[model samples]
Target chain A: DQQVKQNSPSLSVQEGRISILNCDYTNSMFDYFLWYKKYPAEGPTFLISISSIKDKNEDGRFTVFLNKSAKHLSLHIVPSQPGDSAVYFCAASGGYGNKLVFGAGTILRVKS
Target chain B: EPEVTQTPSHQVTQMGQEVILRCVPISNHLYFYWYRQILGQKVEFLVSFYNNEISEKSEIFDDQFSVERPDGSNFTLKIRSTKLEDSAMYFCASTVQSEKLFFGSGTQLSVL
Candidate 1:
């Protein structure tokens, strides 16, 4: 149940700064990692994902970096906006199963 | 743009009552899953259904819990006997072939 860990309970960033949210996994077998954003009373929404075969994936203002050796992944949101403020969750799953183990969410507050 | 939808955004039930949470997965997605999160806790996988049968389930999904894709579009989770610990937000997700999932807003089940 503790396979995925997000050590930070919360993170604060300036609107125009880069916000980096990190996640670590104890299970090396996990090959797929995903970042999700959740607002109050809403379910986690998929933001980005990276496969083990690749080290980096980017989508517009968001980029995800994966380190296979260290078993870590991080999400970087550049020029963060106030609308980007939400609880961010990191999830990991591998192989054929769709079962994702999630880390304790980190509340990201982008200050305007 | 197709998104999963859940009914009865909030449900309140007495202890030991039977409560059913409903969800409508994305039209073209072939895999379905159920995950729940307690207040201030990480989301936990409950079960996954495919081909009209359960493909995998977590330990938290005991005999008291059951999932059924009663029709082509609707997936439902039934908890035979609710307990105090069953109060949480239940999310229904679907995917085509990857761990990237489209999740519903969630059903806030309050077991009193």
Candidate 2:
């Protein structure tokens, strides 16, 4: 299903720069949005999340911004490091976190 | 530091064979889920289990797919009959009625 989409297949950024990954969702029933980071052989690790009631949430170097009206959300990482080079996925929760629809994921390459 | 754990990181099976993927969700987590990602595809939800029963499932999770929590520590997904298209990385996740989903390392199933 095309309920959630990450149009960018990949992103490249330099160290000490900001890397933004964008996502869009057509489903309005979703209430929670999250970003997960995945290394080559590991499962996705939760980075940050935003509730529909809030516009932004931040933790450490990661921040998530939600624009309900625009049906979009973005993950911003400040001072990107080479260790952050991995696939980032955007997922949306539809029913109290019971079911999640994920985007195609964007590969972020951070160069030092 | 608790984490979801999955076994048999990779499995190769012939078409029509039955394969069971195993996972151990984080201790005390009440919700369990299975999601799969085919090569170059989005992560699609397969099913969600709560209170020892399936609460939700996706279209891709046809009759051939089943989930069970045989014990307090084990969650398993069984494919009654494998197909070539079933080849993908299957991730098991768990949460406690929240947005943060702790995912397992994933099992790479190759159906030949």
Candidate 3:
């Protein structure tokens, strides 16, 4: 079963606009959530993360908001740039181990 | 900046052949993991290794799959008698007791 899901397969936004990608999880035990950005033929790189206790975390232009009650989280990029065009994956881990459950990923295309 | 490194970026093997994918995690990281993504699918966890042992493994990590950290710096995944469905991009990741993971560029394995 897919514990983490990114409903949107792809998204398109104009450069300089805000781009939002959403994620949902079914397991409430997950305490840590992370986002990773991936380019074609490249490994995923860390973007940002939020703890179960925190509702939001921001790094540079990227922001992640988590809602525990809804079992949902989102990543928002302000002033999206062409370089922001990539697949974004949402991953979560529970209390026990280091195994991370990943979402299907959302492809973001920031058009210039 | 420390980064995970993987060797043999791409490997093409016969269906019944064996293939080994190698990875060198970041120097000081304590936890290591192997994940794979079939083309157009979400990244799926294969196994998590800590202290030279497997902590947890997914169902996909069946009898044919084995992981080893034979040396201080090298971690390898061996697939015995590969199948066509085993073709995917394998990523090795490491973290130092933190929620964020650093992933390698990945080794794309293709079984013909």
Candidate 4:
């Protein structure tokens, strides 16, 4: 079963606009959530993360908000740039060793 | 910044042939993992290793697949006899204490 899900397969937005990507999970045991961005033929890069202890985390233009009660999380990029065009994956980990469960990625296209 | 590196960015093998994918995780990272993404699908966890031993593995990691930390710098995944379904991008990731993972560009394995 897919514990993590990214229902939107693709998204398009104009440059300088805010881009929001959403994710949902079924496994309540997951306590740590992360977002990764990937370009074609490249390995995914860590973008942002939030622990179960906090409801939100932000770094520069990127922010992640988690709602444990709803089992949902989202990533928001302010004034999105063309460079931000890539596939975004949401992942979760729990307990020891940090085995991750990932969502089907959302492909973001920031049009200039 | 430290990053995970994988070798032979792409590999093409005939069905039932043995294939070995190699990775070198960032030094000082305590946890190592293997994940794969089939084309147009979600990234799936394969296994996690810590303290030179496997800490956890998914049901997808069967007898045909094996992982080894041959040395301090090398972590390898071996598929004794690859099948067509084994074709996918294999990513190696490392983490320190938290659940944040740094992933390699990945090795695209195509078993014909």
Off by over 4 Å in 3: none
- For candidate 3, what is the DockQ-based docking class? medium
The DockQ-derived docking category for candidate 2 is medium
- TM-score of decoy 2: 0.97
Interface RMSD of 3: 1.6
Encode model 1's per-residue lDDT on A5-111: one tens digit a residue: 99999999999999999999999889999999999999899999999999999999999999999999999999899999999999999764568889999999999
Q: Is candidate 1 or candidate 2 better by lDDT?
A: 1
Residue A16, candidate 2: alpha-carbon lDDT: 93
Which 10 consecutive residues of model 1 chain B have the lowest summed lDDT?
Answer: B94-103
Lowest lDDT sum, 10 consecutive residues, model 4 chain B, at: B93-102
Model 3 Cα displacement at A37 (Å)?
A: 0.3
DockQ values per model? 0.78, 0.78, 0.71, 0.75
Model 1: clashing residue pairs? none
RMSD value for candidate 1: 0.9
lDDT of 3 by residue, A11-90 (tens): 99999999999999999889999999999889999899999999999989999999999999999999899999999999
Regions of model 4 farther than 4 Å from truth: none
Score candidate 3 by TM-score against the native.
Answer: 0.98
RMSD values for the candidates in order, in angstroms, are: 0.9, 1.1, 0.9, 1.0
TM-score of 1: 0.98
Scored against the true structure, residue B56 in model 1 reaches a CA lDDT of 92
